[model samples]
Target: MKRTLSVLIACMIGAAVSAADLGDDGLHKTPWMRDTFKDLREDLEEASGEGKRLVLFIEQRGCIYCKKMHEEVFPQPDMAAFIEENFFVVQLDLHGSTTATDFDGEENEQRALMRKWGILFTPTLVFLPEEVPEAASAIDAAVAVMPGAFSKGTTLDLFTWVDQKRYELDNGEDFQRYHARRIQERNNISQE
Candidate 1:
C-alpha cells in the first residue's frame, strides 16, 4: 500500500511538471501572452508599435489540444523566443464573459466575438497583418488562421511565414508548399 501511494504521488508530480501553469480562467498561461483590456484595436496598435504582429490565441478550459501546445510546442526555447520576438500574443477565452472590442469598433463579449470570428476550435491562432482597413473585422483582416494545435515544426513554419509576409510574395510558395519544403529539408538534415 505504501509503495502504491508513493508511485501515485510521483506520477502526479511528473504530470504537474509537464503541464503549463493555468490562469484563474483555467486557460494555460505563457510568459509571452499579454493581458489586456480585450480591446483588439488597441492591441493591434500596441503590437505594431513594438514592431510585432498581433496574434489572437483563442482557447478554452479543459482543452487537451491546447494543453498539448502549451506543453510540447510552445515551451521550447526556439519556439518561445521566436514568438516573443515576432508576435504580441493576446489570449482570448472562448467562453468568457469579458468584453472585447473588435477591430471594426464593435464591442462584444469574448464568446460573442469568437462567434463573430467563426472560431469553433479550442486552440485557434489568428494572425493579423500590420495594417487593417477601416471598418474591417479581425477575421476579415487576418493574414492567416491556424485553427488547431500543430507540431513544433509546423507552428514555427507558420509563424515564420507570416512574419516574413510570404503570403504576399508572388513566388507561389503557399503555406502548404512552404511546410512541405521545410519537412523535406528537416528530413534531409536528419539523414546527414
Candidate 2:
C-alpha cells in the first residue's frame, strides 16, 4: 500500500511539473520565446533581418489562461514549428518593471506600456507588420491583436493568417471567413 501511494504521489508531481514550464518570473516559458532586450524597434529590426514577424506576447504571472496556452496550445508540434519558423516572439510581463522601448522612442515599464495601450488581458499577442511607422507605438503599429487564450486550431489559424498576410487581402475574405473555411477543410479531411 505504501509503495502504491508513493507511486501515485510521484505521478501527481510529474503532472504538475508538466502542467506549465515556468520561469523565475512565474510566467510560462517556451523554447520558442525570444529573450531580447525588450526594445520594440530593435526587436522588429532583428525579426525583419531573420525574415520573421515580430510578436509581442504579453502575459502575467499565475494566469491560468496563460498556463493553458503554454501547456496545451503552444506545445503542439505543428504550432510550435510554425511559430518558431515564422515569428520572433518577445515576451513581456504584464506587471513587470522591465523597461521596454517603443517604436516611437518612448521607453516605459512593461506594465505601464500595456496600460497605455488599454490592454488588460493576461495573454495578449500583438502581431506586427514587416515595417512600422516611426511615429507609431508598438500597439499602434500592430497588424493583429489576439486578446486571450485560444484553442490550438484558432491560435494556429490566427498565426497562419497573419503570416500569410491575409488581413490585407482585397478579396473581402477576412479572418472570420478564412477561419471558417479552414475549419471546413479540416473537417473534410479523413483522419485515417
User: Which numbered prediction scores highest in lDDT against the true structure?
Assistant: 1
- What clash pairs does model 1 have? none
How do the residues 1-192 of candidate 1 rate in per-residue lDDT, one tens digit apiece?
A: 633554455445543334469999999998789999988899999999999999999999999999999999887666676777789999999998999999899999999999998999989999999999879999999999999999999999999899999999999899999999999999999999
lDDT of each: 0.89, 0.86
* Clashes in predicted model 2: 0
Model 1 misplaced regions, further than 4 Å = 1-19
The C-alpha local distance difference test score for the whole of candidate 2 amounts to 0.86
TM-score of 2: 0.88
lDDT of 2 by residue, 18-124 (tens): 33478999898777789988989999999999999999999998888898898888866556767777899999999989899989998999888988888989799
| Per-candidate alpha-carbon RMSD to the true structure | 9.2, 9.0
